[model samples]
Target: MDNYTPPFNQSLPQTAEGVPNKNSLSSYLPIRTKGNDFDFDAVIGLVLRGLLRKKVEGYSYEQFVADCQSAFEEKLGEEEFWQVLKEMYFENKDIFTVSPELLLFRAQKGEFAAGDSRVASMFTNLLQNMRVEEFEAKLNFVEREMLSTLREKMKPDSSLQASEKPYLPYLSKAFREDLKFLASRPKYLLSEIESFLSFYGFTYTVQLSLALVDWRSGQEPVAKPLYFIMDHERASNERTHIKNHGYKLFNESATRLFPMLTMLEILQPSSSEKGAIKVPLWEISKGIQESKLTHLKERLEKFARAFKSQRNLDTVLDESDAALDWLGNVMKLALAQFSIGERFNINKRYVLEVEKYLASHFIQNRGRSGRVLVLNQDYIILLTNLVVGEKDKLRFYELITAFEQRGIFVDKQTEQELIKFYERIGNVERMSDSGDAVYVRKTI
Candidate 1:
């Protein structure tokens, strides 16, 4: 069997002249994992990530069920898998959504019942409501229009109006069903805010496994943006009661992550407007590692306040284009902060003398951790390759003076790190005279 390819590697469709077609995919088109396949985990991860990635806005019962069947191959019965996922949704409610409109667990035969999809029934009712005489023409039109309109409006903190909205073919039909599913459980919606906060809190840990690795590898705290965008959304959503659901979301759950800028005031959700449901923004409300690492928490807050690149923060809507634009802005905004240190929290004092020089040339803010001298070889080579062989002309006290004056201190203990690095590369000499020293860089 061919090695199963990931969605990231798919090529865009090209015309004869070799330019990609304007209409080609941005995100790779998803396919059912039912055909002869081998990489079960890849399929399962991507499918689940895709489904849960957008679960907050709700998604299609049909597409989600298809993804579930594709996840286990055809080995699991379609009805059986759907039942499994519907229950999993309750266990991990934040990540999954089950349309209460469907009586998903009705008894059919011994444990496997082919339950009817009420979501499908909603479309059927819409077809009957439209009073179309022919099935084929209207069926295709309604389904396509419904999906297109739904994707367009489901972006962050945005909603569609059924009564006042302009006439779009599937506008009424699509939301009419969703509003029903959302209004399905008022008792659950009005359940303790603690239950909601617990779910919201788990969101932090969900992405932290990957996030902490990146953080250690000199990457930004990965969950920062995820939590930020969630905050931006929840603020807009908490203003009013859910549409037709008669309850406002407990908006306090958004404070789960540290603010990007320490001094900037956090924007509150809009004031309540009658008949409106504030968008549920499952955001974090506190510092990421506050309880255990108060020191780390203080440092992160300092970085947040110190890094002021994103002065004009923008709204992150649901489109891929909008999302990409926001990501670009975010990365660039954090560049000054990033350039200071590829890594953070330098616990040891004194680095290689060479490293100290390399850092001075590269960073603007001087890195945030325990004296973040340029410890990376890639950066060292890029900035100071020429200076490596010229230690002979350099004076020892002058080197010490330069370090002290510039605030780049390296204690005697750190001398071994420099000696080891230079010895590994070879061709360097160290000599001492009357409490001073001269060293020469090897000729490359």
Candidate 2:
């Protein structure tokens, strides 16, 4: 595989060709774990650190305990300080220890869920210049300022520094725009703000996964622009037409891992193409799934030759009508290093796990289809707040358009449901009986 060169429209890693090149498929739609649940706070911490582009330093529990002791031991007795600390951090006070480091520090392991890396990478790439004021406002003064002081004081002493920082670029214009919209708002320290970020992260990740496409027809491969339809959580099963069609499309696209990788390989230019492409989100939706079957077949042949052994190469090259067979063949060849046997289900190995990854966050099983894309009330409210931004409110239709630009779609029935939901929550203002006159206000 290392020695093989791709055909004109196909690709492998373009390491020697240029800067800002994607090393693997993970660069485009990063899913590094086989199957693991996300830890939201850990993901937030990692993303915050990446956004700063600073040297990472750990703050030990021992140092944290000592700092607390020095600051509060005089004001409150030593025993009282320990009691307060235990009450604040742990539900079980019996686990408290005198040295204090063992409680939190001993359980430290640097492991994070697979999606966490993808989320953090995508976030940092999408948001390169986060406003300091907004960050501080969101986290509040104590979390921002005291953590800074404590980190500076307790930072590990090490001469070694990162040799080089990685160059991760934004892969989707839609995501970049939406993230910028969210960041532009005044950061509120409301309790619901944490839920907003958590759901936003999950929604964006699922949208990216569902909208991804690999275009192999042209001389160069291209990532087809992203868009997806979503059903309101309360949407009726019989009334939904566009939402059902959108779900069918989403289900088909969601399990495609190889095409995603192919798109990444194609998009990774020798030189950065950041300035080369800038199209309105509406213009991009027209180009989705434009790749020809013949082109995909040709790319598959090249992939089989590059990765398969002599015995398996002929087997993979055999003609097939099923897209699943083709994908399974490619997965088997590309992942041949893992020595996957012929009897094992390839879809379970490479495809189904992705669907499983999106389980409760972006997908639900309430509909007849078992798994369908859904936007619940909380996410809609958060999205509304961000889209409305500093404005008092936006025209209801315009707000819907903004949601579409961020790859979220709703049908007429769903839109009516959304308006009612907002109205019930007292965030919607109606000028008249028509949907066009309704305005959506920011919840924050």
Candidate 3:
């Protein structure tokens, strides 16, 4: 035969002296060391123990299970450990009876069975042990629900019915109980009070009542026609010394107070009628005074050069047109103040400032297109540009003071009247000072 050589000649021999080489023997015999040294069954037992502890301590089932999984992964290699875990605690019933040591030994020996039914049975036992903890968590959830329901009951109703009685008695006992609870939590109770006051009807009533009280206490007896209109309804049975005065002064006071009342009405919804029936009179009077001042300032500017030219002797000069114009402007300004005060439900001071700032720009620019500036009741055609340059401040104040001082000759009494007006409504202090107050400057 032609020198026949075997194809297997290069292959390593199976063994030395008829036995395979060490590396070659591994392929056939498959030298199996411990597949995983960890005892998964024992780990399951440890997790069960932890679950029992957590359940006793009132932890939820879900929380207990999560903790168990976390502990196992932290202590063992995540991959090998969980796989073995699923086989033992989940996939085999033997895990429950077998000690962790025996389960681990069997697992290393590769002898555990796997199936969903076996896992299900194991989980059933695990959940049964966690029942107490689940009940505790459910109890906590129920407590939260009860507390929330109680809070809803304690909250005051802001809606006004035809009959103006207090609605607190209509609330359920549970609501009363909630109020008690809220009272114990002072912070939350205050929050509820704030929310109650925020309701339009409630705010209007409270503000009106407070304002009436303040106005009654603040002023002395006067004989103006305006005051009479304000006190006309109660002028007959004058128990208080102030009401003995003529109603005209009361009407003026009422006229002054009308702006505030109008503001309250405007700020509140039409449906709201919760508190007082009438607006206070002093607020209207204050509003009127402020408007007259602003008008006086404007009219004075026109007559400044004329009066200055006449050496302050322009009093006898006939300026019927200017006087009529000034009167009309004052009326318009008063209406504007009332409108803004009502719309924003703000103080007269704030309303006057906002109007002044707006009017300055409108007059300077000679009006803008499609840009209606409604200041309280006064309407102009220029939007207030908040952006101010360095020199803008001095210029604005100079104009306002000059306008005020100029009226000294043309209408000396009105000029004096305007000075008192500025003291009450204008923010002259903020104007003279250069600070962040500029951002909040209400008028020119």
Candidate 4:
């Protein structure tokens, strides 16, 4: 087991054969040190392109500079022109492009390229499921609230291009339905919708990537549950227990990622487990227990045969006790190859690095608890807007349930804090003292 070879299946999934298998461990997780610059605006750009079926037009940084020069060369001197250009375009905080250095309307080219297109493309492809006519109708509503005339002028021509490859995206039905419902709402701003898409885009990508970590031939597809402990950004000393419980639950969920991936990699390949991977999001909120591996006897026999064939082992261990010993050795081998430790850094790269990058927005760090799941104010507002789509307000209790459906959980203490926060911001209407009678409105 100590001298075991790494089991990396280089083959593409059967559903997507003959196409290039660009999916390595890094491609799946996408948490490289240099690739940590994930911009939400850029994510929106990619998703918009994907939804519109537009090609990556070669709009280079040089071309953009030249365009700026042509547009304002006569209006101002070289120094003044550059200063104005920087202030108007580059320094403008509202501009949403794949790279801030480049314009938003087109795909970037040359040395200043699109940052993290692979991950961005995941969102783009997910949005490709939408219809063109419906998207165009929604775009009309978004166009009504343009922040700048330059953003309007820089918009690409109506001509669009379609993707050559088919997309096979798998998301929980509840999330998928909610996303569509949010998109259909005409009151929401384009930036707000983009924020909603970007956050969920990253969340689903993380879950989907981890779920497919053990992908093999004839294996059942599953969505690994991502439990988020919705933290109250403002809480008093007495509410510390609420946060502690959240931290514990969050750690439990995050730490299980690698072990679950490893377990599926080893166990599922040897058996015929059929059914969609139904993740119990709310059920585990009470407390999570370690998953016990079952059907060891049958799995051990199959694993022994496969191991003997692959490693060419000649040992004849047919008895139950001897088989158990071999099974232990096999488990150790698989753990060494897949788990994050001195031996292998798979967990470090895929799990830890991802959480590190997502901090400040999707995650929160507190007193020795490390990275506990959280949604910052900006995200909370975006989510609230989406959850309250097409409606003036939603019942406070129903709103919490909606959050759960999207993989976010909040306890009673946190719930009270949330209502207070919302009330302070003028988004909640309290009909009675009870939390159930309260109604929350969309800030959009």
Q: Model 2, range 387-438, lDDT digits (tens) per residue?
A: 7876899999999887765656676767777888889999999999898899
Q: Candidate 2 or 4, higher TM-score? A: 2
In model 1, which runs have C-alpha deviations exceeding 4 angstroms? 1-260, 264-393, 396-409, 423-427, 433-435, 442-444
Question: Which 10-residue window in model 1 sums to the lowest lDDT?
Answer: 24-33
lDDT of 3: 0.27
Residues 261-292, candidate 1, lDDT per residue (tens digit)? 11111211222435421111111112121123
| TM per candidate | 0.17, 0.62, 0.16, 0.58
Q: C-alpha displacement of 192 in model 4, angstroms?
A: 3.5
* Each candidate's clash count: 20, 1, 43, 0
Kindly report which residue stretches of model 3 are placed more than 4 angstroms away from their true locations once superposed.
Answer: 1-143, 146-238, 241-444
lDDT computed for candidate 1: 0.25
Q: Give the alpha carbon lDDT tens digit for every residue of 1-444 in model 3.
A: 133211111221222242111111011000112121223243332222322222122322234334445556666647576666556543554322322111112221133333212221222222222211111122233233322322222222212111211111111121223333333333333333222211211112222222332332213222111111110112223322223322222223323333333322221222343443222234323333334333333343243323223222222232344333433332333234344423234334433332232122221111222122112111100001111112233333343332222110112222233234334554334444433232222232
lDDT of 4 by residue, 415-442 (tens): 7778888998999999999988999998
Better of 1 and 4 by lDDT: 4
TM-score, cand. 1 vs. native: 0.17
Candidate 1: lDDT of 11? 23
User: What is the full ranking by TM-score, best candidate first?
Assistant: 2, 4, 1, 3
